[model samples]
Target: MAATEGPTVAQSSPSSTPLPPGMVLGPDGKPCRTCTDWKSWSKLAKTKKAQTQQGGSGSESAGASSSSSAGSAAAAAVVTAGAGTDDTAVNATAPDDCPPDREVLGRATWTFLHTMAAYYPEKPNEREQTMMKSLLSSFSQFYPCGHCAEHLRDEMKKEPPKVASRMELAWWMCGMHNKVNTMLGKDEFDCNKLDERWRDGPSDGRCD
Candidate 1:
């Protein structure tokens, strides 16, 4: 549903803290943590804190030291939140009940989409088909990540949703998911496993 273009650095005014390069901003032009990976967000926060402290203090070196200490402490907390030092890591399991990051949001949205596809009627009536198309259009318009929503809209124009049948919808979703995965440099999932993964469970009966 979403794709990534590589990140570029943000420019800031002299008086303001410089955000980390590659930090994505929301529609309001403020830093968007949910739109960014955990590593980038953490770096941006630490940089901003350090810059603020430096501006406030008499001794520049002392301010730097204090900033480093504070940054380290905050990072430690994140580590405890189950995010290791990986650049793509997200605090999905954070103890403080933090909001979902981009990756977490993607996973949840994909789950919903796949499950919906799995249960779709084999022969949807015209009204049901119309409703499904409307739902997808609305979803594309209102998805939380603006860029992601835009990407989905563009992709939809290129290849509209195939919602005529259950299997048709399921394969379409798998193809879309693979497109996203390819953009993110991830391995493509096997579309053949769709029912096994989403509806039928494994042949091994482990999920049963």
Candidate 2:
């Protein structure tokens, strides 16, 4: 009789089975010699989980800080808006060691003067130059209103009803002065004629 063929090796199935400790099956279902040790695999998993938890905690902390910052900013704005306009009240609410009111007014006056100087057209005529100089000098002197009421009244009397309001006139003059100063500082042409046009009108004390 012919020799019987030995039993052939059975083909493994595609589905994987768990092997013993420190062993794993490859994609082909054969034992994987390169499988990581169980201890190392467990340590890696723990490290990954810990990192995820830390990341989540950090994100939460950042969100809380952002919310806190936004709340603080809003509260500050509200506080500022609630403060009244009275100079004394304003000063009291301001930070300690704030600049004196006179100093601030003086600075503002100079700023206005400088602005006017720049905006006034530089006509070669001496009258225009003199008028521009006088306007700047007047603004510099009359600002801070401590003792310049008489001079201010006189000027107001000279202006027309349409331009007489002290506050309105002051604002316009200061604005013009600021613009002139800015232009001059930037090396632009200085035109001193703008003040002359305004000065020609009858002085009315109410600008509003």
Candidate 3:
């Protein structure tokens, strides 16, 4: 969800606040905890805690220092929630019945998208195709990560969803997902494996 390159919007400029590396600022110029992974959020929380305990008047960042107490509390809650367990366990473990981090949310979202594409009617009518396009348009507008949503919208404009048939839709989804993977420097999934990954069991029938 976090923009690996930079802020997503033109309106968002660098804040006076000294945010942790890779922390994303939302449109409001506030730190978007949901945008970045938990590690960055933990760094912010620790910095605030150190300042608070020392009672020092540290240099305040634009949005971070203003809401330090509330933001730090929220970050601390996420960390302490998994207390009595291994300290290393807390990182990237927000999906176990807690609010999901960006990675968890992204994976769950892609799963739903690909599954839906796999199950789309093989020979959908005009109405069905229109409905599918509409659904995707709306999804791009309101995804949890604002920057991610913006990027998807841009991609959609470049190559609109192809919902004419099940195969087309599935391949389109795969291409979109691969674009994201490339952006994040991850390996591209083999499109030939779409059915095995989303719809049918593998040739060996392990899933079955």
Candidate 1 residue spans exceeding 4 A from truth? 6-15, 59-96
Query: How does each model score on TM-score?
Result: 0.78, 0.21, 0.76
lDDT, residue 2, model 3: 23
True lDDT of residue 26, candidate 1: 73
Better of 1 and 3 by lDDT: 1
lDDT of 2: 0.37
lDDT of 2 by residue, 45-117 (tens): 3333444444455465766766554554444333333332222323322233433232244345554543444
lDDT of each candidate versus the true structure: 0.73, 0.37, 0.72
lDDT of predicted model 3: 0.72
- The candidate that achieves the highest lDDT relative to the unseen native structure: 1
On TM-score, the leading prediction is 1
Q: In candidate 3, where is summed lDDT lowest over 10 consecutive residues? A: 9-18
Q: Write the per-residue lDDT of candidate 1 for residues 1-208, one digit (tens) a residue.
A: 4865423335442334555445677777777766776665666555555445544552547647766656654544444332334545543233346677677788889999999999999999999899999999999999887778888888889999999999999999999889999988899999999999999999999998
lDDT of 2 at 12: 29
Ranking by TM-score: 1, 3, 2
What ranking of all candidate models by lDDT puts the best one first?
1, 3, 2
